[model samples]
Target: MDTQIVRCRECPLQGCDTFRPLSEDKLEYLESFKQGEAVFRKGEMIMSQGGKAPHLHTVLSGMLIRYRSLDDGRRQIVNFMFPGDLLGLQGAFDDDLSHSVEALIDARLCVFPRNDFHRLMGAHPRLGYDLVWLAAKEETALEGHLVSVGQRTARERVTYLAVWLLDRALATGVADDSNRLELPITQAQIADMLGLSLVHTNRTLKSLREEGLVDWAPGNLSVPDMDKACKFAQYTQIDSKRPFI
Candidate 1:
């Protein structure tokens, strides 16, 4: 982790249509707000549940997961992060994070000191609003996930997860031109996210594959027609264009 502040204006994410643009004044302050860059290898823990994160992070590149693990050793993956996604800001209002983040692949982050969340909001209200927007967006997606786990069938659950990630990946240009995700995740991880067992997850995935809805493997997923998959999963996609700090 380097402690040198990064120039937010020059951030590559700023050039992507996936993220909202910052105003001249706001961009300048964001540059100062950044404390530096943090790089993580695949499977590295970015932050842990019940631990303090010294800095808030925005995904500069690559993929990661936010998950919560229970005492019995079961874990549920709550969310995934792509370029421009914010991380660790939930620590602002509380002492420790409710969940943990881990890199799914080699990744880079533009980090801002955790304490400055207040300064950004109190001094620069617009930037603060952006933070809330980011939080609310994640909340909305989690709500959908909750509904799926609570009521959807095993097949529907798998379909929903694939659709959810595929939609977001395409929106972020993280997926290839072929509309496929070289997802750096395993079937066991998928089971965790969908609240299913590994055996059940595998069965459902085979069914989907046979049905021609998706082609999924340990580190890859392909959705040929997202609309059809979404319809099958009864998934409502959040707008592809999203705000990020």
Candidate 2:
């Protein structure tokens, strides 16, 4: 694998308005601090739970899934990663990872050494704030997911998930103008994320599809009227720029 470093100024993530703009010197420091880019193919594990892959990453392209598994092989998906989302944050200084991150498609990441995190923070305080902001945002997203699983009906839960993923993909520039995306996640994975049985998940998705609310094929997900679907799911469609790393 090539270890050639990607210049921060040339980063695709840097070009996205969703991310906060970096100062020239801070960008320079970032360009210097990064070791390189890492590529992980579809279904490839970037880091496993309990393994020490001591690095932080910013998604440059593609998507990833973070999950935790039990001894009996039951899995619970924690979150999905899109462009500009930071990875390996929760366990920055810990020896073992608390969860595993796997690529849902061919994904690229801007890699930085874990040991230099504090040095980078001490030198640039705002960057440290951005990191904390990212972590807090992730926590809030998880809270939303918990509410979905605990309170929502199966149809409501699945509808909200599709609309939410579509919104995120659109914000990150991964979705096409027609609101179609190569989502690449399986219904089984969705079941894991939503705490549903595979049969129930399939039925809910089929119902949604029949109503023109969603079309969730194996590697694709789309809605005929994205705006209407968002309204149905009660997802606030943001036209404003959002903050990111």
Candidate 3:
């Protein structure tokens, strides 16, 4: 397969929790990737639901959408990849991908061929632990998405997604002082992920914007105060399943 060359500096996740961090020694290894690498492409099956788990993929920049398609060809996007997120992890134990992964935009990535990745993890136990922690977090996020789709009201759905994005941005250290974050996704894509129609998604966004809870514009979103916005959605970071630490 043909791979695109990209500069390591172009990737936003140079020292994120996902991939092995770039120490001085690692820097040389990462610089090998140039800027604007294809990483992966849309419509190409990066991993199958039951495919072999070989090599791991790391997003340096851009986005990837994970989705499952029905027999009739309708696709439902399950998760969106951000900088530093790992792809092709579902088959860590077996062959075949758990879901399909495709690039939502031009992406840069560094790949650890399965054997080398395993060796790297073996040599760096912390990296191994981090990978496990990441997988657990992904599982939790999936559950949250399920709840957002199945139980949350339409207004709540909008809140759920908004707050989710806000929190994710904060985690990645990209949130601004205004607590506003810029997301360049379209309403149609949002609808597909949330299992809602485009009309409903637009209406919900408009409501939030009018209420002063959020500011929405073309390719940008600003939440003046996340505390106030979360309250509007009845949002809490607390996980209900376990006792408070």
lDDT of 3 by residue, 174-201 (tens): 5544567766668887888889999998
All candidates' TM-scores?
Answer: 0.95, 0.94, 0.74
After superposing candidate 1 on the true structure, give the runs of residues whose Cα lies further than 4 Å from its correct spot.
3-6
Residue 171 displacement in candidate 3 (angstroms):
3.4
Better of 1 and 3 by lDDT: 1
Which prediction has more favorable lDDT, 2 or 3?
2
> What shift in Å separates residue 196 of candidate 2 from its native position after superposition?
0.8
Q: How accurate is candidate 3 locally (lDDT)?
A: 0.64
lDDT of 2 at 44: 96
lDDT of each: 0.84, 0.83, 0.64
Encode model 1's per-residue lDDT on 1-245: one tens digit a residue: 77654578787767777777778888878767777899899999999998988888898888999999998988899988888789887777667887899999888898888776777888798778777888888888889899889999999888888988888877776876586899878999988998899999989989999998877977889977788899999988756567677
A best-first ranking of the candidates according to their lDDT comes to 1, 2, 3
TM-score of decoy 2? 0.94
User: How many angstroms is residue 108 displaced in model 1 relative to the true structure, after the best TM-score fit?
Assistant: 0.8
